[model samples]
Target: MTRLLEILISLAIVAVLFTVVGFILPSSRHLEHSVETNRKMPIVFDTLNSVRRFKDWNPSVAGDPNIKLNLSGPESGVGAKISWDSEEKALGQGSWTISKSEPGKLIAYAIEDVDRGHDKSSEFTFTPTGKGGRNIQITQAYDVNYGMNLLGRYSGLYVTSNIGEKMKLGLASLSNMLATIPNLDYTVLGKDDPALAPKLADRAGENLLVLNAAVPLNQITIQTQMKTNIEWIKKNIAANGLEAVGPVRIITNEYGSSIYSFDVAQQVRKAGTDATVKLEGLKLANNVELLYNEPGKTAVVAFKGHMSNLQNVRDALRAWAMTRGYETIDRPYEAWKNGIDPGFAPGQEGEYDVVWAIK
Candidate 1:
């Protein structure tokens, strides 16, 4: 009887100790820290715009060089996501998406943290701290149930020590990226224009092309094999008086040529019914052809080069055309200048062109 009483008393003492320890440990939800740093507003905003560029500054990226990551969307500026997988538990699985953006002000993100036995949504704010300067604040907060509260507390300690150091490094790297982007006096092009309205034509030219059953318009569409962002092309086309005519369609000719046929009919209805015209391939060699015809009084200048280096040639052609009183009427074409299988490296010689019409 005496031994049994002593055992009961020991059990009560152990229970009391457990309760005290539980009371002392704080809840996981309360264990978070915020990190902030200041940078140029423009630079900060641009760096946070895209998660793909984070590889250049992310602390985890440096630790795991072999980690494989997949990125999606426009690569930058809102709705973009970056995800990665790793054998290292510390860097296992996670993804971040740009949740919000305000040009020069701020960009916030939502983070899905997996592999840490938790989920988190974090926000990074880019606030204008001074004239042309920005203050960036990043807060990582999460919810943890009672069972995992201890783990969360431990994470807080490491975050202030290691994670804090890495995050600061990332911010510094972003600062450098911003420094490289030159600030021009000009504003972003076409900020006031209607989203889809074509600019008014300043110069009048008949330049009409018609398609019939015998000879269809050789609508050609060639995309850069390296996944080109055709934004510049879109802006150029809109900036000029060139208007679209119809539903965009990709057609393959019997000759194994691919053509992107835009409904010029739709464009004609708006610009003028009689403005449609056509041209024939006056010259063809190695799959590169020259389509020339007098659609109107306007002059058309066209050339071809590699897809990767097409921008350079196009720029040069634009300068040449402008000097000679010409403007672009179409989003230029790649005429297969190098042939079906050209032996050249990427950014090497390929079938591309810069075509323009002169007044």
Candidate 2:
């Protein structure tokens, strides 16, 4: 009886010590992780916001397939919810509901990990590279709320490393998934403020098949001019039996008297040294010319939409360069990207990278 009484007293003392220790432990934790990806901002934002695709990139869900999820509400955006029930200890039972959303900028969620029936919150921010406009900085932050209990505080202490690893894996999965999609679109991913963007870099030299045209800017719009140039190049590329490799590049040879000189060109796969012009439609017969673009320092900004929206992009780039003590030289140009589709139509948006030569 004395021995039994002594053992019971010892266990009670140890429990008391644990309760005291809880007072010194932190009551909450915050974990943040970030990754850089070449995937466009809209695609990344849309993918991350969809609860139905959670298992594809979410670490906790991916770890345990036995977890059954009940995704209810709208397909995406605010009000979407994904609740899970799992026998596996790792997954447990939980739910996530979208609390806030900003299409291409941010998405915030309220997380309820019901394994212990508590609530937390998470946020994701998609910012431009500050260097490369073609890429984005994807960041996720977790604000963990630990209950005011001895056991809760103890568990929070061990969560940091495990959560970080999962975040890294989840980001990798997201990058891979976006890369596999056939045709992805790009919208402006950075802040409208250009002062925070990166410095202009050097552009490389390239040989191109160009169709130069000087048109009265007042008589026609930028869209009409670019479309006419693009159609001509497409026909010429087809006639030559060659494939265009990259964006359709345009160089403004001169800008005066409301007249703009445009050299619309494409870098194509060749048979040997060069390609001979053979296009015979739209009054462009025997008008094909080849030009080798000299490499120079340039700044790039992504424009998402029609060519008419190009002035805004040019203005932004000029502002960014002026703040950095740079001057525009020669003229600006654009390289059409395979943004949504390789083709265009009325009101259809696409990604076009505007390049400006600077000194």
List RMSD in Å for every model shown. 16.5, 14.7
How many clashing residue pairs appear in each of the predictions shown? Answer: 25, 0
- Which candidate number has the best TM-score? 2
Cα lDDT tens digits for candidate 2, 215-320 = 7874345446666777777787777666776778767676666877778778765544332333223222447665555678887776666655565566556544
Candidate 2, overall lDDT? Answer: 0.69
Best by lDDT: 2
Per-candidate Cα lDDT values, in order, are 0.44, 0.69
Instruction: Report how far residue 317 has shifted in candidate 1, in Å.
Output: 18
Superposition-based RMSD of candidate 2 using all C-alpha atoms, in angstroms: 14.7
Candidate 1 stretches with Cα past 4 Å from truth are 1-43, 114-117, 131-148, 185-187, 194-359
Clashes of 2: 0
